[model samples]
Target: MRRTQLLAGSALLLIAAPVSAETLKDALLKAYNTNPTLTAERANVRAIDENVPIARADGRPALNLTGGYSEALLQGPGTNSINSPDRRTNADTQLTVPIFTGGAVRNSIRAAETRVDAGRFGLRGAESDLFTAVVGAYMDVIRDEAIVGLNTQNVRVLDVNLQASNDRFQVGDLTRTDVAQSQARLALARAQLQTAQARLISSRENYIRLVGDEPGVLDTPPPVPGTPAGVDQAVEVALQDNPSLLAAQRSRDATAFDINVARASRSPRVGVVLGAGYFNYLGSLGAGSGVDVGSQSGTTGTAGLSLTLPLFQGGRPAAQIRQAQARRSQSIEQVTEAERAVVANTRAAYAVWKSSEQVIASAETAVSANRLSLEGVRAENSVGNRTILDILNAEQELLNSQVTLVTARRDSYVARFALQAAMGRAEADDLGLEGGALYNPVTNYDRVKNRWSDRGRDVDPQPVATRTNESKPQGSEVTRPLDPILDTPVDRDAVNAPSKRP
Candidate 1:
């Protein structure tokens, strides 16, 4: 019984222990596997892939069957039964194979294939965008948590100072004004802590929304890899590798093909038509006829080449060709626009990343100097050379600098990630996510591009992304215990003591 009790106690301890810290890569991997937006884009690309086979089907053979039965209720008085076939039944089957479509079928297939490539590049763009958002949210939480910790610590320190002020006043060593100043500072510190905690909660909620899980103790993220050394280099890489630009270029190529498909409307179409039919007279052909019909059934077969030329289409073909040409022009302009945007974004991200580094360096210096200044002011106050307000001001400056430092670090990291994304290097593969193979749009495209089966289908889709509502409610987990001394009332008699010079 004692051994059983010991075992249960050990299990309870293990259950209560905190889980290991979650790393940035872990959060990114989860978002990659479960983000709804990325998943939907992937599905859209797969749908686009089907267009290839759909276009090809237009050039393939088509077979159709028809059957019918009919009976004449009344015939003309002079009509012959053999010629009219009073009761009749017929069945027919026809097969038509396209011999040539004046390049319409060929270009349509090419356009569809090009669009599939464009969709794949678009998927890559979506992936990069999602990873950038996750990186921002992750950094925001870390920054807010640090700010909350700083404010909480400030509150505790102020509470202790307030108590000391009350003690000095009771001994007639400090004035009422000094104690009031300390109390006011402590109140402000508490308010700041509350605000910081609120911001922290908001950041955590955002993190959960994107990452699909409550954030645990997050490990500090490593520096973003593959950062370009300069803006020019970054822009050059972006112009070459940016998914948005590449997708736009592909779309332009597809539109060129679209123009060819439309111009084919004026060209002649040729095909082979083969048909077979059967007819039954229902035994009514020889009834009451002077001549006896040898048989009441017959079969017919025919095969021939079919041709169609567009003589005049009420100017519709010309209008369609012009429309396609205009669309190709628009696509060409869009490609240029995408390129310009990529260059601007790459340059801007690089600038921000560099500036953030400078801000971090400056903030660190300010924090260190402020800390030394606060210490000196406190030492001077101990010798009655500095006023209480001077020490208070020093502490406030130090807190401000420390908060700035924390914020700058977070900004720097997020900006670096943005830069990497702009340069087309922040995707899942670029990040080296583990635990599974990366989702390749080509896999789905290759599987469906040449498919000929009519009944093939994927399994019904279940929800891949996790819902946030099912997770625990977000709260400020970075809160610190309030100083117990803050709750105790100051001795009223000490507060009522007359002011005295130190």
Candidate 2:
């Protein structure tokens, strides 16, 4: 039973070597360059780009060319007939242009443009999610690697202790029971070391899946940038910049235009129609007629303005309007929900990050105290004031404390990344990933917005500019009314509050 306690308390305790190693930025860059999910979202944004041209086409002119040919036969009891066999051909060219639709086309274009804006924000949200995932996976690999090392050392140390106990038992200086205890502890340590190694392997596999490559000798991640000064400040920044909330806000704006589109159905539609046609008829004249007719041909042209007033449509337009209004309301509620979720998540992450700092500090102090205790316990054992078991227990305590410290450090780093994500800053550009590509939805939107051809651009314009979320420093300051009320200087104490029970 005590051996079980020993094994449980003495988990893996490892210190990573300080050397030239793979940085967190490198892993992040790898994920950013090749993540399939990010690539798919970028494609989704481009698909949204088509909505603009489709809406614009509604207000453009359309023309058609038509032609037909026919042959006919007529017979009348072997006598000359006025109606005889004949062949004819006809052709026409017609054009129609929309003059007005009570602003339907214009509003539709507005709605589509708004959706495109929302889609851009959606893409940004996806980017933040991807980066966050990469950060977690990278940390897991490092943590597991450290655990495996500690376990390996534990097994080795236990084996040496078991050998010493066996020699003492042979000399009758230690009991057989003591030797058995050492053997049991050694065996358990070996088993745990195996388990730790397996977990490391699993963590490496997950790292490969997310980061697009196996992890090398990974270095400890550097401190994340732009941590909020306080939890309240984090909430404020998130309300302003969280991509999900921004996306929801833009979605509400898009639905506002839907109301106009639905209402436009009740108004008059005006258009212009122009048509020209040519016809030819050929036959032999078999009766006495006023005019000779070997062949006849004529051309005709017509132009008119068309108007369609919807006097009534079985209340369909009114029903559509109601539906649009309901959707707009739904969008408004979604924005509110998004804001709430962002605030809750930001506060939660801030609390965790703030508390992890204290946990790490306490664990470090515990490790130091435990180390000193172990040294004194070993000195006592050499003077016959302590037993071999006492020394082993002291060492186990030291190792356990070291394990706790490592865990606390890992949690602190992960929480910091989480805090960054919550504040809408865990993006490649914000993280300063080097030599990675950033997908700019605006560049793709601008490329295809005005395209008139069915076949798209032969070559897309390359996005040469760097993408970032920060506002330009040189721009004239425009302050929102709520900013003065909500903005506060960074409070380190608020940002680093005590941890709470879950």
**TM-scores across all candidates?**
0.88, 0.81
Overall local distance difference test of candidate 2: 0.72
1-502, model 2: which lDDT tens digit per residue? 3343333333323223446577888888877776777777788888898899999988999888999987656555754434553566889999999999998999999999999989988988888888888888887776666566555556656665676676666766667877777777778777877777777777676677677666766776888777677899988888888888999999999998999999999999999999999987654333344555555768999999999999989999999999999999999999999999998888887777778788878767776777677667655554556666775676576657666666666777877877777778887668766673566778877888887876555557454222322322221111111111111111112111222312
Best by TM-score: 1
Q: How high is the lDDT of residue 474 in model 2?
A: 20
Q: Which stretches of candidate 2 lie over 4 Å from their true place?
A: 1-20, 71-87, 282-295, 383-389, 457-502
Q: List clashing residue pairs in candidate 1.
A: none
TM-score of structure candidate 2: 0.81
lDDT values, one for every candidate: 0.82, 0.72
lDDT of 1 by residue, 368-469 (tens): 788778777766676677766786787788789878888888888888888888888888888989988999888888888787777899999888888888
Best by lDDT: 1
